[model samples]
Target: MSQISRGLENVFIKTTALTYIDGDNGILRYGGFDIDDLVEHTSFEEVIHLMLYGDLPTKVQLQRLKTSLNEAYEIPQQVIDTIYSLPRESDAIGMMETAFSALSSIYGEMWNKNTNKETAIKLIAKASTVTANVLRAKEGKKPVIPESSDSFARSFLSASFARTPTNDEVKAMDAALILYADHEVPASTTAALVTSSTLSDMYSCVVAALAALKGPLHGGAAEEAFKQFLEIGEPERTEEWFKKKILEEKSRLMGFGHRVYKTYDPRAKIFKRYAQKLSERSNEARKYFEIALKVEELGIEKFAEKHIYPNTDFFSGVVFYSLGFPVYMFTSLFALSRTLGWTAHVIEYVEDQHRLIRPRALYIGPLKREVIPIELRG
Candidate 1:
């Protein structure tokens, strides 16, 4: 039986160039390129094209895709007003969910079952717009629509702040996006696939994915890791804090441990470098860098023997924090990158409609017995 049919096993369905797992050696690959290679040598937009179209784009092809995304990066005024008027404390994930729900009302006809490939392309291109706009609105700023000629990574970063980004900021964000662009089918991606299997619209599928990614164990970790640093108070005290934290029932250091990666997370190594560069570029508080380095060192030195290593979330926290992104928006940006992978998987599923992903469950309760009347049962 296939892993999808078994349900409990990690289901790593194959693709021509995608890699799903290295359960024994702990590696991740996409399109035959190791994650480490892609992050250093490729842009996030290029990676998205690679996954979706199944090969790296030529310079001309990549430029065209960037242009399409840039054109699609504007939100309607009504959507912006709705987002800005929400209460300040509204959960970011909830904001995304509500935003998507509202979008469904506006684009009802474009997301129909019979919608053509052109409509699908627009949805894929515009996802970054809806996402970046929400983050800016929550901060009481107007969103910047992307300029058609702007680079994909720069447009996303700039749109969130409604301003053009500096060269350094764009470079850092580009690398961050590439690093996060995909990871096999995680639990949240599975949630998206399951939702899409029901023939839900693209907005709903992406919203379901955002909800799943918002939990502490998933996309929520990057922000939580920084929160932990704040609570630690001093860089020198981190090890002691960890000692105390490990004993507390309420504590688990987010971003330090990953379900995958018995060794270092391939993407983390690339992001770690960018985090350092970003720290210097922004002239960040030294404590953040100090704490991050200590955490990474300690994570490996103390926990490597036990198979715990820092994931992409740890260093990404520093990179994003230094870039002035609110911690709550960490997963939203993650959603931005991972959206490409989600669409790719959805397209693959639509192509391979061999099964609806139905799986069996083990019944562990009492054996079947005769039913009784309500009074007798009580």
Candidate 2:
């Protein structure tokens, strides 16, 4: 047998044209456009169109896509009720998973052998609605339905926070969403793809992705990274905290490494700029940014030799926090942005002569062991 690749590290599954990553060189591109260029030049809606349709939208196409997404933002009443019924202490991402599962029942017609762009748009739009309402229900606030006039990023932020956001805030949030829109195939995307390979409905595939993303090592990393900044408290204390917590105590840091990126994550670079820009407007945000910078400096000093540097989760928490998101809602925000990628991959895989993503496990236990009766086994 070939040497087992634990965790399937560096394993190639299938081809995709959606997103590309040159991890060794710290490059990311959606379709064929570089992420940095996209973040600077495109709206979240535009990136969604690019990912789903395989090209940037013209003015008319972009408006139609926006209208479709805006119209789809109102989730089913039953899904909202389901969100409210969950315990207040329920994990936010988990609540989203449950909500999407409930959404699948209402859109039962979507359960077919093949998925399409319309289904992808609906799931992408409703992901934000479900996530916003989940956070609102947790805070004992009523859900806010988005107006059709609102832009995609604005709709999510307004609905999530129950207030209108400033233009700068909307721009920052849009960039954040675009930066997180897709990343080739991470754990969550792979989870979605695997479920899609089984000819599952899009909603069920999203639920599966959410389940995988809830782990600390995956989508949950941003929340954990924010907690670290809060724990550090003061910028001045970062070095001592790093020494005690990370050096002497040998504690693992949450946000500084990636499985693929050998240098700084390209998304992290974009997020860091946003974090710095947003930090200037809020004292609390500034403090977190300062502490994050210090931590990044110290971390790079220690680990740069090995090519481990800040991943997307590093400064992303600070950006989310600055944008008025609670720490708990970080991963759900990830799910919202990633919905496009998940559905895109699903559509691509199913359309490209789909195959079940089943792999074999090497058996190591006693070969050909004979089963004994319960009475004799003892």
Most lDDT-accurate candidate: 2
Deviation (Å) of 221 in candidate 2: 0.6
TM-score to true structure, per model: 0.89, 0.97
- Which predicted model would earn the best TM-score? 2
Name the lDDT value of residue 168 in candidate 1: 84
Q: RMSD in angstroms, all models?
A: 3.1, 1.5
lDDT of model 1, residue 54: 78
What lDDT tens digits, residue by residue, belong to model 2 across residues 225-301? 88999999999999999999989998878898888999999999999999999989899999999999999999999
Whole-model lDDT, candidate 2?
A: 0.88
Worst 10 residues of 2 by lDDT: 106-115
- List the candidate 1 regions with Cα displacement exceeding 4 Å: 1-7, 13-16, 19-26, 105-121, 247-250, 282-285, 369-378
Which portions of model 2 show Cα errors greater than 4 Å?
110-115
